[model samples]
Target: MADRRSAGSRSIAIVGPYLSGKTTLLESLLSVTGATTRKGSIKEHNTIGDASAEARDRQMTVEVNSATVEYEGLRWNFLDCPGSIELAQETYNALIGVDAVVVVCEPVVDRVLNLSPLFNFLDEWEIPHLIFLNKMDRADVDFMQVLHALAAVSSRPLIPHQYPIGHGHKLKGFIDLVTEDAFQYHSGACADPIPFPEELQVEEKSARQEMLETLADFDDKLLEELLEDIPPPQDEILQDLKMELGADLIVPVFFGVAEEDYGVRPLMEALLREAPDPSATAERRGLNDADNQPIAQVLKTYYTPQGGKLSLVRVWQGQIEDGMTLNDVRVGGMYRLMGQQHQSVLRAGAGELVALARMDQVKTGDVLTAHAPAPDLPVARMIPQVYAKAIEADNRKDEVKLTSVLGKLLEEDPGLRWEQQGDTHEIVLWGQGDIHLQVALSRLQRKYNLPMTTHQPKIPYRESIRRTTSVHGRYKHQTGGHGQFGDVFLDIQPRERGAGFQFTQKIVGGVVPKQYIPGVEAGVRDYLARGPMGFPVVDIAVTLTNGSYHSVDSSEQAFKQAARIAMQEGMPRCKPVLLEPILNIKIAVPNDFTSKILRLVSGRRGQILGYDAKAAWSGWDEVVAQLPQAEMHDLIVELRSLTLGVGSFEWTYDHLQEVPERFTTQVLQAAWNTK
Candidate 1:
C-alpha cells in the first residue's frame, strides 16, 4: 500500500482465448502476490476474479474483472479479461486505461489462432504489450513450434523473454532470455529466486543473443557493437528496450506456467523495468487542460458496500482533491476502491488511477475535467449484434429495479442496449451475443436481485399487395337525432419494391366533402400502419378516387369505418403476399471451415455478396451474404456449433424478399388466427 510500491506500477490486462486458464492464472497471481492467503480454484467457485454465480456455474470468466497486487516493491493492477470473443469488447474497454497488455495465450498451435482479434486490437490501438505463454506445465508440444505458430498469427515480433526448460507435466522451469538465468518450479506456486542451471548455459547464451539482437533492432549503437564483436552496456540495452516498448515497437514475450508460478517473478521484473508507467502514457494520451484545468477520464465504475458508486478514474491532468467543486457539478464524495476491501485515499494525482465515488453524472468514458457541464469524452463504441424481446416484470413489482439494472449494465458495457420495440409492445435488449446478454442478466440478478426472462424478438415483416383492385366501403348507424354515415372509394395499385406506403387524391368534384375526404385518407393511413396480415403494409399506393359522406353524421370515426371496410373487401382480391426481412451477413470463419460455412449459408437461402480471405488472419476466410432475417435469429448458435466456437458474424436487415407460396399462405393463416 506504499506510494513507492506503485510508483512504476502499470495496469496489465490478461486476455486470450477461452478455457486458457485465465481465471486460474488470475488466482495464482493473487496468491503469489500475497493479495490472497490461499489460491482459489475455478471448479471450487472461489476465485477472486470470478465472484458472480453465473461465472461459478460456467466455470469460466464471463465478464472483465480488475485486481491489484504488490510484489517486488511495486504494485500491479492486473485486469483478467474474458477470453471468449463474446466478451471481447469488455476486454477492449479494460485495455483503455492500462498502459500495456499481456496477451495470455495457450501453448498450443491451433488454439493460438483465436487471439487474432485481440492482436489486431492491440495493433490498432498501438498499445504496448507482451506474449505470455501460459500452461507451460501441461504443454507437451514444443515451445519453439508454438512460437512459430504464433509468428504466423501475430503481426508483432514475439521476442522470447523466456523458454521452458522441460515439457508436459515435467515442465520443471524456464530459462530467462534476458538475464540468462534458469528458474525451477517448486509446485506451481510462488517462485523463489534461484541460481541458473549450468547445463542450460548453451541455451541461455543463444537465447540471450536473440534477445540482444531483438533489442538492437531499434538501437544502431547496439547493432554496431554487435557487428564489431563488442558488447553493449546492459543499462543501455535496458533503456532501448524500455524506449521501444513505449513506442509500440517491441512486445516483450514472457513464458510461465501460471499454475506453477514458475516465471512470475521475472515477469513482474520485466513489467516494472520495461512496461510504460502512468507518466509515460499521460504524455502520449495528452492532457486536455494541462496548465490550469483539472482533467480525468472515468474508465470504469462499480458499486461498493459502503463507498457508494466508486468510479475508477484515471487522472489525465491536475490533481483530484478530496473536496473540490470543479464547476459546481458535483459535491465529490470519497475517493476509494476495494483493495481486498474498501480503502480510501484523500487525493490521486496526474497519471494515477483511483476511484471517485458519489459524483453526479460521472460515468465511464466521461471527461471529468473542470466544468459544470463537462465536455463529453470520445469513448469506445461497439455495434450490437444480438437481440431478444423482453417483458416488464411478471409480478409488476420490479419495473424500477429493472430500469436501474439496465442503466447499470449500459454504463458498464458500452455494447448493450434496450428499447421499447414499437411493433410488438415488447421491451427488447440487444447486444453483442447470447453470452453477452446472459452475463448482463446474471449481473442484474446478482447486483440488484432482479430476475428477467428473454425471448427471441418478433421479426419485423411487411405485407404488400402484388395486384391492384378498387373497392368501396360504407357505414351507417342511427342512434339519436343525428345518424352516422360515410362512404369511400379506393383505387389501390402496386408500387416499386421498397416504395413503402403512399397516399394521393384524384377527386376533381367533392363527392366526399373536403373535411370528410382528409378523414378518409387518415383512416386509410392508420390501417396501413398495421395491415390485416398483422404486418405493416408497404410498397402500395392508395388514391381516394370517389366517396360520399353526410355533413352532420360524417366524422373521422365514420370515415375510419369506411376505409376499414374498403380494405377488408379490397385486400383479398389484391393478391396479398408475405415479405420476409433479408439480412446482410458477414461471417468470419477458419479456412478449413469455409466449405461448411458456405453450405450453411446456401441452406439458409442466402445470396452470396462476396467472399475473401482475411488479410489480417491466417487460414481464415470471410463470407458476405444476404439471407432472411428469420433464418438468422439463431444463426450465431449454429455457426459456433459448426465451427467449434471459432466463427463470428455481423448481420442486419437488408431488404424484404417474398416468402415461398406455401409459406406465405401459412403466414397469412397464422396472422389471421393470432390477430
Candidate 2:
C-alpha cells in the first residue's frame, strides 16, 4: 500500500453517464471509510447524494453533492456530480477543482460511447482520471471486450491495473497486475488473500505484460527492463504509475460492482497509491504556492432553505478562517458538507473543499481571494442552452419576484439562462433540455413559493408586403365646436429582403406642416407593429407624399389618426406575406451517425449547407444547415437520440425567410389559435 499521509487533503469527483452507478460508488466509498455508519440506498431515497427534493422525486442527481470523509488519516472530499448529459455543466464546473476523478461507468459495450464527451473534456484539461467499470457482477459480456469498447472512446491509452478473477455474477475476486496477487471478496468486509488460480495464469500474464508495456512507453528504464526480459521491481512500477497518472499520461482501468461493495476497497487503495495530491493539482492549475495568500474558486453554489446562500469552494492556497474577508465580502460561516448536512468548522486549509455560508456576492466559477488581485482561475465554459420555454407567473403579482428568484437560480446553476424576449414580449427561460427547465421551475415553486406556467416559446415572426400601394385618408370628426380635420397621402412599398423598416416624408410645398409630419411617421410605425398577417411588419418603407392640415383642427394627433386609417386600408390590399426566423446551425456528431443526422435535418425542413470533419475531434463531423426557428423546439431532443447523446449543435440567428406558401395557412391558423 502507498502512504497518502503526506498528500494532505484531496478532492475527487464521481462522474459518469446517467444510471451508471456513480452515486452508488460514492455511497460505498463513504461507508468503507467509516464516514457513515451504513450505506444509503438510492431506491430508498436515503442516499447522501441526490438528497434534494427534486432529485429524490426524480431519483436522479439534479445537482452536485459534496461530502468529506477521513480515509487512513487523510481527509478526502468527494463530489458526486449529476450524470445526465443535460446537467453536464455541473460536472464540468466541479471537475476543474478536484485533484483527481473516478469515472464510474457500466460494463456494457454499446453504452460506452456515452463516455466520449466526458473523456474528451478530461483529456483536453489534462485532468488525471481513472475508470471504474461498475456492475461487473451483472455484466454479461467478456471483460476484455468491455475494455476494448472503453478504449475506443478515450483518447488516452488505457492500462488495466487489475484482472477479474471470474465472469458475470460469479465474479468473486481480482488479480492485481502489479503485485501478481489474488484476493477473494467478502460481503461488507475486506478482501482476503487467495491462491492465484492456475486456470487464469495465461490471461493474467498477458494483461500484466500489456500494463507494463504502456507504463514503459513513458519510462526509459522500464522500457530497458522490458526489452532485457528482466522483471522491474514492484516499487519502480508503483512509482511509474503514480507519476504517469498524475501527469495524465495514461488511464488506469479497474472493475467491480459498486452496489455490492465488491472492488470498492481496491478502488480506494488504487486512488491512495496512484492519484495526484493537491500540490500536484495546484501546480497544474498554475497556482504559486509561495504566495500563501488565501485564494479559492467557487465550484458550485447553493441557496439553502435556512442558510440563505452557500458557496462550495476548493481552497487552492492558504488557509481560510471563519469570517475571513474574501473579495471584500466576509464569509459568514465555513462548513464541511456531508450531503445536505453541514458540519460547522472554524477553519479550512488548502486543498479542502468546504462551503462558505452567506457568500451571496460570490457566484459559481468566481475566483475569490483575500489579497488585492490575482490571475483569475479558469472556469468551465457554460454549455449552450438547447431548450427554451416561455414562462409567466401564475399569480401575476409574483412577476417581479419571479425575476429576482431566477437570478439566484442562474447564479446557483450557470447552465440556466433567462431573458425577456424583445420580439415576442415574453419571459423565456432556457436550459440544456426539458428536464433541466422542469427542475428549475420546480425550484421556483418549491423554494420561493412562486408557481409558474410554461409553454413552448413563441417564435418571432414578421410580415412584409409583396407589392406597392398608394392610399389616401381623411379624418374629420365634428364632435365639438372646432371640427378635427386632417388629410394625408402615403406610399407603401416592399424593400429588398433584410432591408428592414424605413419611414421618410416626401411632403413638399408645406402642404403637411412639419409639426404634424412626425405624427404621420409615428402612426406608420405603429401600424407596422402588427401587420395584416397578425405579425410585426419588416422589410418595407413608407413615405408621407402629400397631406393637408387645418390650422385649428389638423393637429399632430389628427394627422396620426389620418395616417393610421391610410395604413389600415392600404396594407391588406398590398398582399402581406409571413416571414419566419431562420437560424444558421452547426451540428456536431460522430461520423458514424452523419447519414442519420442528414436525414433528420432534411425532415425538419432544414437546408444542408455542407459537412466537414470537425477540427481536433477525430471521427467526428460538423454539419452546417439553415433551419427555421419553428422547427427547432425539439431538435436537440431528437439529435441526441440519434447520436447516443454525444451530438451537439451551435446556432445563431440568420435571416428571416418567407414562410413557404404551402405551409403559410397552417402557420397563420396556429398563430390565430394561440390568440
Find the candidate with the highest TM-score and give its number.
Answer: 2
User: What RMSD value applies to candidate 1?
Assistant: 3.1
Per-residue lDDT tens digits for candidate 2, residues 1-675, read 245676678899999999999999999999998999989998999999999999998889999999999888689999999999999998999999998999999989899989988988998889999999998887485899999988888888998989998989789899999999999988788889999999999999999999999999999999999999999999999999999999999999988888888899988998888889888899899998896888899999999999999999999988998998999999999999999999999998889999999887889988989987856788887788889999999998998788789999898889999999887889999998988999999999999998999999998999999999999988889875878888999999999999999998887899998989988988888888898989999999999999898888888888888999999999999999999999999999999999999999999999999999998677789999999999999999999999998899989999999999999999899889988
TM-score of each: 0.91, 0.98
lDDT of each: 0.74, 0.91
Error of 2 at 181 (Å): 0.3
Query: Model 1, stretches more than 4 Å misplaced?
Result: 1-8, 70-73, 188-206, 231-233, 288-293, 304-308, 326-328, 371-378, 387-392, 589-595, 613-621, 642-646, 665-675
Model 1: residue 604 alpha-carbon error in angstroms:
1.6
Q: Report model 2's TM-score to 2 decimal places.
A: 0.98
Distance from true position, residue 565, model 1, in Å? 0.5
| Model 1: per-residue Cα lDDT over 355-456, one tens digit each | 676775766777776664555544555745554546456556888567776877777776678887677777778776678778877777777777777667
**Considering every candidate listed, which one attains the maximal lDDT?**
2
